[model samples]
Target chain A: MKNEDKDLTRRKTIGWILRAGIGAVIAAIVVKTSRRSSGGRLVWQIDPRKCIQCGKCETACVLQQSAVKCVHGIQMCGYCKLCFGYFKPDAPRLDEAAENQICPTGALIRKFIEPPYFEYTVDEDLCTGCGLCVKGCTNFGNGSLYLQVRHDICVNCNACRIAEVCPSDAFVQVPENDPYLLKELLPRET
Target chain B: MRSNILENCMLNIGYWILAAVAMAAPLTLTAASRFPQPEFDSGYVAHKMPHPAPDFAVTPMMDILILVVALCIAVVLVRKVRSRNWILFFGLICLGWFGFIRNGCFCPIGTIQNVALSLFTGVRLPLVMGLFFAVPLIFSLLSGRVFCSVICPLGALQELFIVKPLRMPKSLDATLRIIPLIVLSVGIVCAVNGAGFIICRTDPFVGIFRQSAALPMLLTGMGVLLVGTVVARPYCRYFCPYGVLLEICSLISWKQVELTSNECINCRLCVGMCPVDAIEAPRPALSDKVRGRQFKQFLYLLVFLPIIILAGAGVGHLAGAGVAQLHPGVMLVEKWQSVEEHDEDLFPSIEAFKRSGGTIEQAKMQAAEIVGRFREGCMYSGVFIGLILGLRLLVLSKLQGRKVHQASRSRCVACGRCFSVCPNK
Candidate 1:
């Protein structure tokens, strides 16, 4: 009985030692890694420069309608009489006709500003994020239109399905405070 | 009037000169500069892009607080209160909060990959994720498997669905139990080699919680739940990588849930109550002769351990080459080869690579490196699995004699069903 009691005590001591050792290791890892860890919430965004306009973002998202939407850089716009982003390349005339629009969903709304310059805006409710308009703008005119993850609609899946299928690997994680990867300035050669 | 006309002519000439300079500039300049910004005569301001706010507002600190509070309640309920109904109610709350409300991301089970990746590859482990991984383990060491009992949303989800619990054969149960250790080893190996979080990718419950998963994953979740109705916490018992860690911790835990507060009446009422088959019946003491034979068998098995591990490594080395095909880089190379052979159109990935100015030679080299890493990871994982299996066999060969019906320290989830069923209570 005495020997059994001694065995029990020894086992208990070993358990305690193991627990303490594990706790210390955990503490050390936390202290060591915290400094290098990316602070704050990390949310997914797209780098406009690397995006290939693959049109996968429309169908690949976990949401019923994708969180990706076409964002126009108003400052970058050429404000041309015939905006490629707003109208198809082979449009019969520079008019706001549904068949002539580059956007399949007619999400791009063109408003007359002056005799020569036109103002373009995206209707978020109607935008399907197919990147067709983006492709048109990028190929023919100033590449101002780009797809971005709208945080309001995005559930922020751990593994973004769109990122998985992205051919150019444009998807990147940005800090929650600055989620949008906006095209503020034109890409210039260094 | 003559001076004003001269000013207008000079301004037009200056604008034409600027346009000429821009047109002559190299193509390196962005397309945006092709057309000059219209000088808005009406003083109209261009609309700046709007950054919408995120929907979920819960902070990491709040999540940690709730996790800690839930663990404490589980421990108290299991050890002190000993109410199965209360534990069930608590589990339901955890399922709602962690599963549905949080969308099931960054759970302890999935954190195993992050922790493994961080430890092996020197990747910076997020502070919140590190805490999420460690706290449950610490709690399990202090108190046996209370985390598994009520705190884990996955386990809770399974528990909620358990109906008509059927007993599995002891041999089958023990065999299936080895799968979790294998999964843990493979999961860690994949994470360390930067392959990807296989555990999170394959998590059946997370899909159900998020309500937005691929068709196969949804089908898998439904299948697991359907199986869980009879098997009782099938994922927890046979598949959860985190559960393997919790089981180890709980085995050496300082305290455990008592089946009965009073002396065992030997009525055997609680034996059948445990849905997970965690209860052990009394065993007759082994004679010295039988013990000597078992000791000899253990000694023989110990000698074969190294040979077993080497065999496993050899098999893994072969399997690794095949498994490496799962990597996207390797798949890309394979696809490129097939396209070359068949004279097919370039795939999207290949097109992107070509557009980015990456040569096929560069892609082939990257794929070769990933294959090498996969082989190394698989070999290491094989060794780990072999070691675990050997140790398990050794332990099983020399079993201890039990005096009364009791819960298995490592297996019992502390759901308190046994306590409710114990006649002595």
Candidate 2:
């Protein structure tokens, strides 16, 4: 009986020592890692310059409807009479026709401002983010139309599925306070 | 007429210069004006870009508060209340909050990778993520694996599916338990080297909680839940990397759930009542000769430990080379090479690389560097695994006499089911 008591006490003391050791290790890790930590929440964003518009964003997201949507930088738009982002490259006419529209979903709305200038707006609800319009705009006109992760829709998965399959490696984590990485915006600012 | 032709030629030259500048410097041109916007006769103004705010229903602070409260309640219920029904009710609440409401983001299971990556790389661990990783471990050290019993949503989800528990063969159970340790080693290795978060990628429950996933992943989640009906918390038992840490902490916990408040009556009612089969039956004291044999076996294992570790390292070095192919840089280089060899039209990544002005040689060098890191990490992981296996064998060979039926310190999740079965209360 005396031997059992001594054994139990020895085991308890050993447990205490291990507990203290583990606690110290955890504290050290916290101190070391916190010094370098970015100290804010991060959300995934697509770098427009790197994005090759591989069309994976539409399919790879965990959401039923992808969070990625085309966002236009109006400042960068040329407001061309024949907008490559709006009309198909081989369109029979420049008029607003379903056959002549570049966007598969017709999410791009073209509004006439004057004789030769037109305005383009994206319908976020209808935009599938296939990047077909982005491809056309970047290749032929002022590359104003680009894809951005819609923060409101994005659940912000811990490791984004789209990021894993992104051909351009365009997906990057930005501070949640300023999430959009749109064209005409400097990368460093975000 | 001569002056008119000169003016037209000058205008064409100006347009050419503007187009060349636009093509060469897209970003700078965008920052300025690529093609000058036509002066608006109607005075129509361009709208400012609208940035939508992210919806955070339960903020990080709220998540931490709930986690702490659930853990505290779990400890009390398991230790003081000792009611399986209360634990079940509380676990359901945690499941709803952490699983469906939060969509399983920022979980302690996935936080292992974040902590690891932060430790080894420049990737900064968020404060909330660091806290999420550490708090459960701290609680486990203090009061056993109360976190597993009622706080972890993944475990709770599995617990809900348990219909009729089946007893696994002892040998099979022991063998399967090694998988979590192996997973922990590989997960840490991959995360530290910035490969990927294998834990989050392989999580079977996250898809179900979010109600969206690839077909394969959704099927996997369903399959785990279905098997859970009979097996009871199979993922927690054989797969969870975080559980490996919790097991270690709980092994040396300050306090753990006791089977009874009174003396043991040697009744076997509580035996096999544990859903997880954590109860160990009482054993007669071992003979001196058997102890001597075990001591001999221990010494033999000690002698062979280094050999085992070296063999493991050799296998791991080979497997690491294969695993390195999964790295994006390595995969990109391989794809580029294939495209070059076949004279194929440029793929998206290859085109992106060309646009970025990166040479193939530079890409190869980068891939080589990543592959080297993988090899080193896998070799170290192999050594660690081998050491764990060796130690486990040595411990198993050691003879320890027990006189009472009690919960296994490392295996028991402190669910308090055994307490209810004990008539001594």
Candidate 3:
């Protein structure tokens, strides 16, 4: 091949390399940035200061079932037999009968804590968004159980459907720019 | 000589003006949404524009007719480049301009449907839904690829950037063709699943020409355009789903962008010149006796067509089933299908379940059926696209390869080789 032809080929080859390289770089940036930011250490949590954990989260979500699972604040519980969070005020029986217990998934296990005292801990897997337990606890006893948005499932539509219908309007459009919403219980005063 | 140049210049100038007018008028009038919003430091979110179809009475028929007219004009131009026909090309160009610019949309094939669906369905915000799928198919049936040749913003932009052209190897071009099909298949799968429109999301060229300032998409668009300067319409040739539609349409087209000004001499001047590598040398015409023998074998083509279609569809159906089997969403939907007597009257009442504190695992199981059906839809679309491309290749192989031609089909990048090569020009 002639010298001129060789030079042209060299130029074209360089051009192709530059183009391909640039395309790859741009694609890499987009795929990296648009992710839900699970990499951050702070997970989505319920703010104890803000949460009333009303059963409304259970009803208004667009998902076939709401994914707002109830979380427990173990430190706040007094372990009373008449645990306000566990039983409805109109309960006919105090024993662990299905109708008497407010927890639907039977996630909250109630254990006897001496005379007139009971303690409660939550089993994460079976908890559904019925919020009956949350309503029982917050209304009659110290508000410990609360509803929180699980980032894993929330589609995070630009306008959250739940936020619109929320009676408490508890749902907030947290910035994807800074993703975590906390539900931590501060250390109780000794 | 001056008069001839003047006429050609006049034609070119007229088309340019029509293109501008076609683009601007629609944008001003209808104000359709700008897609893949350009990003900048100011953080300007793309302002959502109302659907323009209502204002102009846009319909699939209008898109189809305009494409047909455009095809007619293109055919006439190659067959006989007259001043009057040039006028027709201008008119068609104007329609394309009106369709896009005035309407403030890209490729009206699907835009009209999007508007209608938004006004009527009250569901998902479709990026490019409804009529888009139908518009291209109808035009492909009536005339050759009208959308790809002109009017497509990407195509129009490509026309400007292709200042120089170089030949790509046949092996390379064939390899590149595979990429577009893969992209089209992926896009279809994503769309069917209601995930997102991959075509709009991943469009690199649209970003570059339109100055999509969105850093990520804009950067991608720039990357593609820069490649075009060297490779020539890389997006259209290798990736555009619209291109796939056009290729299928070209097969049945009464009008073709012809290679030769007169009879094929096998000189191959046109082959090297085509930037998109469209032109090829004609095969040796059979003598009457040879032709008679070929005619005897023509019945086989009819038999093959149905066989190909059935095989394609069957394969597509099975693949779709396979995807449905794997997706969690499909499985979830299946569980809910039998239970019709629900509060909301929908199989998977997501809201009701959310209230109950449901897990993703549960939703996945319940929504599985919906997911499966969508996969099945996507698989069929993929198989059909594959069959069309296969048929195109089969027909293309029968023609004479442009081996000895000065410009082979693979070598030509539609760089206007024959325009200057023409003795008439």
Best by DockQ: 2
List ranges where model 2 is wrong by over 4 Å. A1-3, A35-39, A187-190, B1-32, B340-346
The CA lDDT at B323 in model 1 is 71
Q: Write the per-residue lDDT of candidate 3 for residues A1-190, one digit (tens) a residue.
A: 6997999798767655644454444334333332233221111233434444545566655454565766665444445455556765544456677766778778787775445555577665677766777765554445556566665544333224355434333555343334434332343221
Select the stronger candidate by TM-score from 1 and 2: 2
Residues B75-163, candidate 3, lDDT per residue (tens digit)? 44434662333533453465445433333134543232233233333433222223334444444343445455444556656655766
Worst 10 residues of 1 chain B by lDDT: B10-19
Clashes of each: 0, 0, 65
Which candidate number would show the highest lDDT if scored against the true structure? 2
DockQ of 1: 0.37
DockQ of each: 0.37, 0.42, 0.01
- Look at candidate 1 and give me any clashing residue pairs: none
Q: Considering only chain A, what is the TM-score of each predicted structure? A: 0.91, 0.92, 0.62
Candidate 2 local lDDT, B1-425, one digit each (tens): 77656754654464456446556774544433456767788988989568797776866667678899889999999988998899999999998988888888879998888788888875676677777888899999998999998988899899889889899998999899888877887888777766677888989989888888888898998999999999989999999999988988888889987888788777988776888998888887789999899889889999999988987787778778787886877888998887754453357766666667787898899899988888888888788778877777777774788888888778898877888888998
Ranking by DockQ: 2, 1, 3
Against the true structure, candidate 3 has what lDDT? 0.50
Best by TM-score: 2
Give a tens-digit lDDT track for model 1, residues B186-280: 77766676555678777898877877777888898889999999999999999998998898788878898788988888788887778898887
